[model samples]
Target chain A: MRILEIENLKKSYTTPDGEILTVIDVPGFALESGEQIALSGESGSGKTTFLNLVAGILRPDGGRIFLGGEDVTALSEAARDRLRADKIGYIFQTFNLLQGYTALENVLLGMMFGKGADKGFALGLLERVGLGDRAGYKPSQLSVGQQQRVALARALANRPALVLADEPTGNLDPGTAGKAVSLIKEMCAESGAALLLVSHDDKVLGNFGGVKDLGEINRAPRGGIEK
Target chain B: MNRENVGGIFLIAKKSLAQHRLSTVITVLSVALAAGLVMAVFSIRDQTYDAFTGGPAGFDAVLGARGSQLQLVLNTVFHLETSPGNIPWEMYEAIKENPNVELAVPYAVGDNYRGYRIVGTERSLFTDLEYRKGRKLTLAEGELFNPEKREAVVGSYVADKTGLKAGSKFNPFHGLVFDERQKHAEEYTVTGVLEPTNSPSDRVIWIPIDEFYRISGHVLRGGGGTYEPRAGEEIPDRYKEVSAVMLKLRNPQAGFLLDQTINRQGTAATLAWPIGRVMAELFGKIGWVNNVLSLVAYLVVLVAAGSILASIYNTMNERRREFAILRALGARRGTVFAAIILESASIAAIGAALGYAVYALILAGAAVVIRAETGVVLDVLKPGPALLAAPLAMIALGILAGVIPALKAYSTDVASNLAPLS
Candidate 1:
């Protein structure tokens, strides 16, 4: 079954010049459960915008987005938020770990919005990410690779059906990036969660089972201008 | 939300506050200072009221020469002022014999011992006078004065200062001053020292009313030179006078009737003033000052609330990204809003605790000073309405202050915040 499906998705932004800039226009897209796919794009190609749309953080100008068999576009903002919290996991390129919380607390934070969050389960995820010993360390105290691993642990902590990772290995060295990518894929596979990874780096894209370029799928012009 | 989620939210707020140590301490201490000032004022106001109303226990009315009623109570009861003038001794005897009177204690005031007022009354002043409700005077070391002899019972404070004990003899000064030539020829031996009553009575020396009349300077000035008695000579009974008569009525309702009778029917007329009404009027005259003080205290609390608002509001810009991150992590906007509000409330709660601590310390110090200076014991632990209201009001104000910042956090755009990452 498809964990995520999008039909005629559209989004736009208005410029200071009073011209409408369409940032995303996708005719169709689908991702099967338990599948991992890479989404590649250059800067400003609406890769992040598509991810935000799927996560219900931003409203699409026009579209039908199905996640875990529920129509996201038909839901209210609040209902979409509840749906996202229950079914979707997002990993930012910046790691975006709360600076005030410890590594273990960051993982626990993902499960807080959902019912029946377990502390031992959060600890298990941290152990799986090789951060069990560093659970008490804050994000600032961890290296870039460790912080990214903590973020990956937190993303999978809620056991969501799909994970959208935007440049998960962007800030790491090549060796650490390969290890982080493997960990993300391995953790998602273990949880039976589909992965939609966004990256500009071909080396990072090479590790995924399938690949799609935003330039082809997004019908919007390169500079958010009409053709 | 589940229990875990609530605990997690509190943990986040605690960690967030800890992350900004200096700002948290500054905000908390400012609140503490404001609360402390308010509590201190309330405590002092309560102590002052207690001192005024509770000092003149057991006495219903004061009958003295026509003058300021408050002055009469102050002079006869608290020993705080000089006598206005004396009523004739015959008038006191007439009032003492009245059917409505329960106890009538006459006072003869004209002399001082080293600045401490020397009061002349019957021995009943010791055995009958009541200070703080039902508490009669007791001798700490010696015996009560003998009514027929030249003996004195010094108050605790007079004894403590002058080292006067039983059997110590001293000559009384003519008036409040200490001129050697003005010292009366008659001498009185201290027979007792009363225990500390924590009232103005602690600072006086009591002598017999008969001996008081015999003192050379006791003769009324306008009663003619024939009333003057030579040293060691006996004075005529018609020359005798007493400063005031403190009456405790059999039925407090009879005070008004007795007051009318004293002013209208006595051989030598006097005014009977109800002590409580006189005190209430005195308090009413100065009540506005307390209101103004209380207003200033509440304003301090308002300013403290502003500090909480400013403290949280100033940091809201930097916290937008943090809130955005929480939203992206599946936290509802309500969670973010609640966290901000809870953070401000936590600061206020802690500040109020510290404020009460500081208030207790201040009251402890003030109690010592008040007891030493005015002989009025302040009960620091006495609970008043302001005790509960002050801190609760502080927290309510704190929540109000948090609203502005919480609203800002709630409206933060997550997609815009995460755009830079892409």
Candidate 2:
């Protein structure tokens, strides 16, 4: 079953001078559980833009985002938030863990926010990522690799069916990027979640099952994968 | 929302606040200091009024050779100024003998000990008084004045200062001057030391009217009196003149009727209703200042609240992404709004409480200075409406402060905030 679907989506920004600049135009796409896709393009390719639209973090000018068969684009901001928390998990390029909370506490923050009843599950996810010993340390105390693990733990804390990662390993060392990607893939496989990874790094392309150029599509009419 | 659920937002707020330690401390301390000032002022008002009325049932009214209402209140109610007339003891006797009168205590006050006046009245002045709390005046130590003996009952404050306990003797200077010839040349034993009432009564040395008279009359008759222990005189013949007479009416409404009756009868003294006079003169005269003070207090509180809002609003610029993250994690918009309000409310509450406590400490510390200077006891704890007035103002301030932050949090655009932090 298709866990996510998108129709023709459009997004624009109004400059301070009142000029409307079209940022993205994307045709429909769908992804089923356990499928990993790499969205690749040059800089300003709108890979992250498409992910934002699918994750319900940005409202497209015109489109429909169907997540788990629910039209999230038609929902209110609060309802969209609910949709995001329940079905969409996002991993930022920079692991934005709240600076004050400990790593385990940050993981718990996601679960505490979600409808999940098992708070300890956040800790278990950290253990699964092999950073259980660093749970008490804050983000500043953790290395880039450890912080990414904590971010991933938080991402999977709600067991969302779809995971959207924007340059997940872009900031990591080449050796650490390989480990982070493997861990994310392993965790997504274990959970049977559809993973949409947006990155321009050539090293990431061959690791995924499918690949597409967002630069070709994002600048095309309605920005579809097939220009 | 369930409190358990609300706990999550609070946890976030708490963590965020903890992260910004210097900011949080500054905010809390600023709030606390403001609140402390408000609270202290109110506490002083309470403590002052508390010691004044001593729970309200203490004295009825002052019957003096009334000139001005404020002056009469100052003299009789507060024992600060000297009453004008002698009011012949016969008039006090008449009121005491009246069937309608409950108790008529005559008072003669003029001499001072280190600036605190000595209030000479009949022993009934202390004994016949009943407080609202059902507590009677008992000597903290020693016996009440021996009626026939030339003895005095010193208030706790007076005893505290002079270190004169029961059975200790002290001679009175004939005048208010510090170094003056002793009048009537007799030592009066302190038979009792009254409990500290924290009122004007606390500062007074309560000697018998006869003792006050003997000293005053001797100064008049002998021309130059010294502490020469006069010939064995059981009760000095010169103990008749007094300063003023205090009349207690049988009914409160009867105050006017009694005043009419007393003044019309051409009595030696004048009649005054203390409560009526206090209401008319005290507030009437200072009402504008009080109103201005209230306005200033409100403006100050408003400014404090504005600063709080400004601080939160300023922080919100940096916190937008954080809120978006929270919302993405399933925190409701209301949760975000409430967290901001909670932070402001905490500051306000802490500030109010601290301000009140500071106000109390000031009053308590300055109690003696106030009593000695103005003869008005400042209640550092049991304040009047001013105490209540302060927190209500702060709460209003809290609400005002919370509004801006809450609205900012509510209007936070999650979509733009979380805009693909690439």
Candidate 3:
């Protein structure tokens, strides 16, 4: 049932004046399939950094990440990319589809980069996300909420084992945000996919079953979350 | 990748390109411009060679009375100018009898009609000289001339312009140089009309030498039957003789042999090779300059390559986000690299195709204009090594243009791109 495990993960960055900045240090963590987890933090508390690290986008200075019992952190960059493409899906808060591609094209764009998902399956994914009629519409033609649905459809198109969404509903209204989270959770639950939602939203934090606060481990919270 | 996936990439590329119509149009236009330039250069070069080579029908070398070699070649091989001196019909007969000679054709060109020249030659000319498509001279209406008959075979242009086909008649024009005959003594029936040769022959009026002499003698007499010299002076021997003889050799190598024999043995005769004379004249005037021009063309091509590189390099800045998106979607650095390269190569290929087509069109137009104005015919289509150079260079250039961009794409960091930029 356990899907992802991270141990002694440490990431750092170099400042302009040559200072080394250690950003994140998570001792250990584990998640099971169909489990939803919230990573909550104040501003500048390395929430996005942790997500990028776990997603295999960034190499930790020292760590071991086990996704589906496979030691992914020990793999090469190219091998990591292949593993990520096969097993993981990411949803950004901004819904960053290519400017020229239509909504259906953007959803299909992800599958075009993956292994075996076809065009018809991609279109079916769009229909599942309630954007079937808006398939031909470009990102420019869609509202912010609709764009997020397109991004969600794109992320779930490959039926990935884990969905990592970084503040996916951050720019939407409470009404749209509530609908977005519930829809995303419904898809994740339907596919039995593990969800790692990175956000500072208290409302979202209350919704997830498992929650990890960065402040509790960092010893000092950088800022307070509203409400 | 599956076929479906490849189709997806193609669809994305095509749809993206379609959306950016302005940029696509500009890129396509640039390609077309380059293609046109390359095509024009090749077409003109080929056409010029064809027109010059085709105009002279089966003549290996021209033998004439000792004078300018260039003049003899021009008159006998191209029919462009008059020969400086005549080789008397007797010498023409002797060359024809030589064991090494395959066939000998004689021509006496010393008269013109409304700018078109009058040529006096044997009837064998109409039968033996074949034009393009292996065609022989055939009268549209009447019979050909008899050896004793005062009849002429008017060419296609002569018939069209003068309305004189086989059966119509006309008086001979005055002089080869002056065009002022005091008395027109000989009148000839138009016995044959030639098909369009698309060469200088298309504008000529062919008559027998005897008929030419009868008119010339009478006209030079100044309104009387008795021919006279200019106030007790002797007439030049050339004035009373034929212009030049066009000879076909049993072997092409006989041209060199005949030239050597004439220069070494004949006291008053010389042989002129048309190809040698024309190439000599051409290289003498433009050979040195041609090297400079070729160097310039090569430099222009390099500049075009550089421009392509510059265009792709500039575009890479705008494509960073796109590359990042692909990376996040699990595209390996090499895939992104290959995609950039593929895009650059496609543009170059499209451009080269367009440029080549434009070049061909311009060359064809130039050929037509040159033939119409200067009577120098050129073939618009001919395959040559020089024509292939541009497209090959362009494809190489396109690959070169993709190099830097491909490298840049391969070096992009997925880590930095996962979190949206501030």
Candidate 4:
């Protein structure tokens, strides 16, 4: 089954200098369940904007987005949020765990907004990620690699149909970067969720089975600006 | 939203409060102080009014030798202040015989026994008087003093403080204040100890009028100093003058008639009727003090509310990323807004609940001071409007304080704020 399908997805912004910049214009994209793909792009090439539009974080200027075969374009803002929360999980370049919450609590926080929080399931997920003992540790207390592993666990917490990994290993060293991409792909396949991982680093993309370059696929002006 | 899901918002708010524990605690303390002060001030004001206006119970008016009515009530009823001259015995007899009079009790004050005033009166003061409505002045120990004897009735507080129970004997001092060398030659025996009246009468030492007259220097140092008679001769009625007369009329209207007859026509005495009005007037004059304290309490509540606002508002700049993270996690904008407001309201609710303890402390202190000064025991546990309103008002102010910060949180930009910090 196709987990995500998009057509003519477009997004742009007006510069304060009175110039309109077309940041993203994608003709077509589709990913089947359990399929893992990497979309590589240069810096400031609208890579994050494409992922944001797919995740429903940024509304498209024009186009239709279907996630798990449901038309996402027709949903209200709140409904889009619900759809995003219930059906998609996002992994940020930086491990974006709430600093105040413990590793276990961060996992539960992901479930809090979706499936009602289950302490037993959240603990099991942490145990599977080999951080069982560190469940009580806060994000600040964990090392860089451990924090990223925790973030990966949080993304799959809701068992969403689609997972969007934006530069998942951007902040890691070359050695840790190789391991993180493998762990993300293995977890996504185990959960049977389609993975759309984006990155600017070639070595990070080299670990993936199939890679698509955002610069070639995206029909939009480059170097407009990256927020 | 499911009930379990609703807890996520509360959880975020509660942990955020814990994260900023110092500010939360200080805000709670300030709110507690303001709420407590508000409750204490109004309680003390109310109990005081009840005690003062209630005056030495059962008497509608005080008749004294021409002078300040407040002075006469203070001296005659409360046992404070010096006697304002003295009314002659004939004048007392005439009022006692008046048709409007239900009861006329004469009191002559000249001396003290260890700082407690010695009020000379008839035995009827104990048998016929009501300390409070329908509550007679009953003996807690022994019997009433004999009218012709040098026996005395010690009020509850006098017994407690001076260790003067029934059968105890004490020498009277020459004046109202205590001085060892100035003790009178004769000693008066305490025949009884009165029960707790919760009024000024609970602090007096009562003796018979005839015996008070015969006390050695009283004849010579009398109200209008009279000629000293020989040792064995009885003091004449013409020479015997009472300091004031406390009158209880048959009807409330009788006080007006007595006031008109004595104050306007009689000329020999001043009648202070409906003693409540006099007390109310006194409260009205000193009311500004209450107003000032109330203003201060109000200002603290405002400042505490400001503190809540500033505390939450200050943290908004740092937590934009946090809100954006939650927003990206499927938490609604309203969820973030509610969390901020919930935090503020929680601080106030906790503070207001704790404020009752503060109220208890303040009121207990005020009760002690008031009781010592006026013998009016305040009920510290008594609830008032401020006690109920102050806390709720603080919570409302807290919610009001939360709005500006919550609005900031609600308007956070996800795409911009969610960017990883370098």
Candidate 5:
């Protein structure tokens, strides 16, 4: 069963030069339930744009994005936000945790817009990510690796059907990146959430079950800016 | 939003504000100072009006030699001004015998005991003059002044200031000036000390009218050469005069008839109602001053609202990433918008509350000094509707200040913000 799918997706942007630049033109894409895939791409290859499109943060100019059999592309911006909140989890390379919130609070924030956001479940997720002792620490107080782990815990808090990791270990050292990637994969597998891990690093790609290059999936021309 | 969700939003806003401690404190304190100033102005205006208009003496009319009615009331009733000339003893006799008059207390004001007014009147003044609506003057020590003796009854303020107990002797001055050259040769012993009434009379010394007439420089119309009645010398009725007659009417409606009759008949004295003409003129002259002060106070609050706007608006640029993160985390645009508004409103609410607290403290401190100086009691605990409404208005201004920043937060580009990470 497909957990995420996009068909004939198209997105474009107008530059300061008043030229319409197409950033993403993907003919077809799909992720099976509980499947893990590495989306490999060089710089400026629309990998983040693809993730943003699937996460419902940005609307495609023309496309059909189906998340759990619902055509999210057809929904209003507000409805798409609700769908993203209810079904999809996103992990940014920067670990985008609110600096003011404690590690536990960051995880709770993910479940804030969803129903049944229990503190016990949030604590359990923190403990599962090996940060239960550091739950009271703010993002500024945690190490990069520790912050990434907290982010992974937060992403899985709402029991999302699909998790998009956009270079989740990009800012870490090699050793820390390896450890963070392993923890992310383990957490995604345990939660039974499909993973689309976007990265340019070959070492990050080796851990995934399947791999696809964004250059092949995205049909936009190579010379244009991909944002 | 449900109650639980609203609670969550507030929790997030509270934590966010805590993160930016310095900016938050500065913003809130600025608002507090403005609110405190506005509240203080209003409180003082209310207390001043109450003190001046609702004085202890409930006289229906003050009759004095033809002059400013306000000055006549000030000199004779409030002891705030010098005598506006004097009315004859025959005029006082006529007023005392009038059918419409319930009580007529004569006042002869010229002398002062070290800056406090010395009013001369008969024993009837202490017995018949109502201090605060049927409340008569009660002595704190000794008896009322004897009409035949050259004695004085000191008010509470005079007793406190001059340390003049019942047995203390003090020479009266020729006029309000307290120079030794102006002091009379004959001394009047203090016979009584009146209790504190928290009125203008609290700051006066009362003496027998005859002793007031015999002061060395006081001239009698029919005779000269220090008109002092030596022991058994007769002082002609035509030689005597009193400064004013404070009348209490049997029926309050009679005050209007007497006031009109006195002015229309061109009598030697003019009748002035203290609460009506005197207070009306006073408030009319000072009402614009209050209006200007209130305008200034409101402008301060407006500047406070501007500070709130600047504080929040200045932070919107840095907070875009934070808002984008919230957006991607499943928070709706409206939720983020509402959260920003709630944050501003919370700051305003806290500031307004602190402002009122500061205002109360100031009033508490000022009340002691005001009571000592003017005998006006300021009650800080009594909150009027404007007290509550002021803070509510501040919160509304907070919400108004938040609109622009909330819109900026709502329209933040989530993809652009997250693209930095990519």
Candidate 6:
């Protein structure tokens, strides 16, 4: 089953200097169920833009996005948000856990905006991430790797069908970065969610089952545009 | 909790508030104090007005030396203000002779025992007068002062403060103030103590009318030449005077006749009919004071709301990413907006609820001073307009104050804010 299918996807933004900058113009893309694929791009390749378009976080200038065969791009902004909440889990480069909430609460926040947050399941997710004892610790209290593990658990919190990650190990040292990538892949595979991770680090890309280059797939002019 | 669950907005706001615990607590307490102050101001003003307008019930009118009716009511009815001047004893006798008058009691006040008013009157003042509608004065201890003897009937409050019980003797100062040097040579025994009437009557030290005139310093200002009475000399009726005369009419309607007959035409006295109306008018006269106090109360609430706005807005700049994270997680923009508004209202709701305690504290403090000054004991638990409405208004204002910050949160850009902090 195809978790996500996109065709003729395009996005652009006007520069502060008033010139139009085209960043992403991908002709086609598809990810199979539970398949983890990595996409690499230099800084200006608009890799994050593609993830955002697929996650329904941003509107494509023109395209269609089908998640589980349902056309998401045709939905209203609010409806798209609903679809994203119910079907997509996103992991940021730096762990975006709420500083005030406990580690368990951060994971629960994923399920919070979805159907509901089950305390027991959230605790189990924390335990699976090996931070069950530190469930009560805030993100500020956890180590860098531990925080990422909590984020990984949170990403799978809603039992998402597709997971989009943008430089998930960008902040980790090379050693911890390798471990974090392995943990992310293992966690995503266990949850049976298709994974699309974007990164510039070759070490991080080398761990994925397959990798794609954003520069080759997205046909927009680079213009040193921000990803 | 933001919006989906029972704990949505409150739970999330609670966590957010906890993250800035010090500022949150400070803002809440400021709001509490403001709510309390506003409620207290309204309460004290209203109850004080009620106490004054709801003065002692027995007297329908007060006849005093020709002067301000308010001064007469204050001096004669409330034991406040000095006597406007002295009315001749003949005026009391003349009003007493009216067929419409049920009873006329005279009061001659010029001295004080330890700052409490010393009111001299006939025995009929206590025996025949009712402090409330159907309640005559009762003695708490000892018997009523002998009408012809040198005896004092202490009011309950005077007795409590001065410890003036039966067999106690005290010299009166020359005026309505405490003075050791100006004490009269004559001393009077406390013959009785009055039960608490919760009225001005509770603050007076009552004595015989004859003794008040014979206190050695009263001048015979009647038709007779001014003659300072010598000891053992009897002051003639033609030489006697009373400060004010309280009249209980055969019916309340007859007070209008008295008001017409003496106050309207005769220059001998001023008649204050409908005593409560007189006090109400007195309250109206001092409405500027009420307006100033109310302004202060409203200002405090405004400042409290402003503080809440400042507290929430101050941290808004730093929480953009947090909002973005929630947005990306599936929170609708309205959810974050409502959450911010809900947080502010929650702070006010908590503060306003606690405000009643602060109201109790303030009212309790104000009660002591009010009772001392006006001799009226107020029931603190009495309900008024401020009881419920003020707190609700505070919450509404809190929500209103949250709008700007909530709008800021509503417009937070998820894509930009989620960009890694460089």
Q: Pick the candidate with the highest TM-score.
A: 6
Poorly placed runs, candidate 1 (over 4 Å): A224-227, B110-115, B148-151, B154-196, B211-236, B264-272, B365-373, B419-421
lDDT of 2 by residue, B275-361 (tens): 444535565566576457546656666677776777677788888888877776667788788888887777677677676666666
Q: Give a tens-digit lDDT track for model 5, residues A1-227.
A: 99988999998889888988888999999999999999998877888888999999989999899999999898998888888878888899888999889999888877887654679999999999899999999999999889999999889988999999998889999998988899888888999999999999989998886999999989998644744
lDDT by residue (B1-422, candidate 1, tens digit) is: 55655765786678778987888899899888778778888988887676766534467888888777788877877777778888777778788998888888988887888878898889777787775566888998878887778899998888998989999999999885557778888889999999887777877899987788778766654253346545455655566777898887888667878776766665454554667678778888999999998999889899899999888888888888888888887777878888888989988988888889878877888877875555666776788876777888888899899999999999998887764734
Residues B348-389, model 3: lDDT tens digits: 777777776777777778866775544565665566665677
Candidate 2, residues A121-180: lDDT per residue as tens digits?
877898999988888999999999999999999889889899988898988998889889
TM-score of structure candidate 4:
0.92
Question: How is the predicted docking of candidate 1 categorized under the CAPRI scheme?
Answer: acceptable
TM-score of 5: 0.92
DockQ for each numbered candidate: 0.46, 0.42, 0.44, 0.47, 0.56, 0.46
Clashing pairs in 1: none
Fraction of the reference Cα-Cα interface contacts (below 8 Å) that each candidate reproduces: 0.47, 0.33, 0.40, 0.38, 0.49, 0.35
Q: Model 4: how far is B34 from its true place, Å?
A: 1.3
Query: Arrange candidates by lDDT, highest first: which order?
Result: 6, 4, 5, 1, 3, 2
Q: After superposition, which runs of candidate 3 have C-alpha atoms over 4 Å from their true positions?
A: A217-227, B1-12, B50-55, B130-151, B154-191, B198-200, B215-240, B274-285, B288-300, B373-376, B386-389, B417-422
RMSD values for the candidates in order, in angstroms, are 3.1, 4.1, 4.7, 2.8, 2.8, 2.5
lDDT (Cα, 0-100) at A112 in candidate 2: 63
Tens-digit lDDT track for model 4 on A1-227? 88889999888888788888888888988888888999988778888788878878778999889998888887887777777778888999987889999999888887888877888988887887889999999999999999998998888888889999988898899999999889988888898888999998898888887899887788887854766
Q: What is the C-alpha lDDT of each candidate?
A: 0.83, 0.71, 0.71, 0.85, 0.84, 0.87
Q: List model 6 lDDT by residue over A1-227, tens digit each.
A: 99889889989989889988888888998999999999999887898778878878888889898999989889987778788888999998987888899898887776878867788998998898899999999988999999998998888899999999999998899999998888888888898989999999999999976999989998998778753
lDDT, candidate 6, residue B282?
79
lDDT, residue B264, model 2: 70
Give the interface RMSD of each candidate.
3.8, 5.0, 5.2, 2.5, 2.0, 2.6
Task: Considering only chain B, report the TM-score of model 4.
Answer: 0.92
Ordered by DockQ, highest first, the candidates read 5, 4, 6, 1, 3, 2
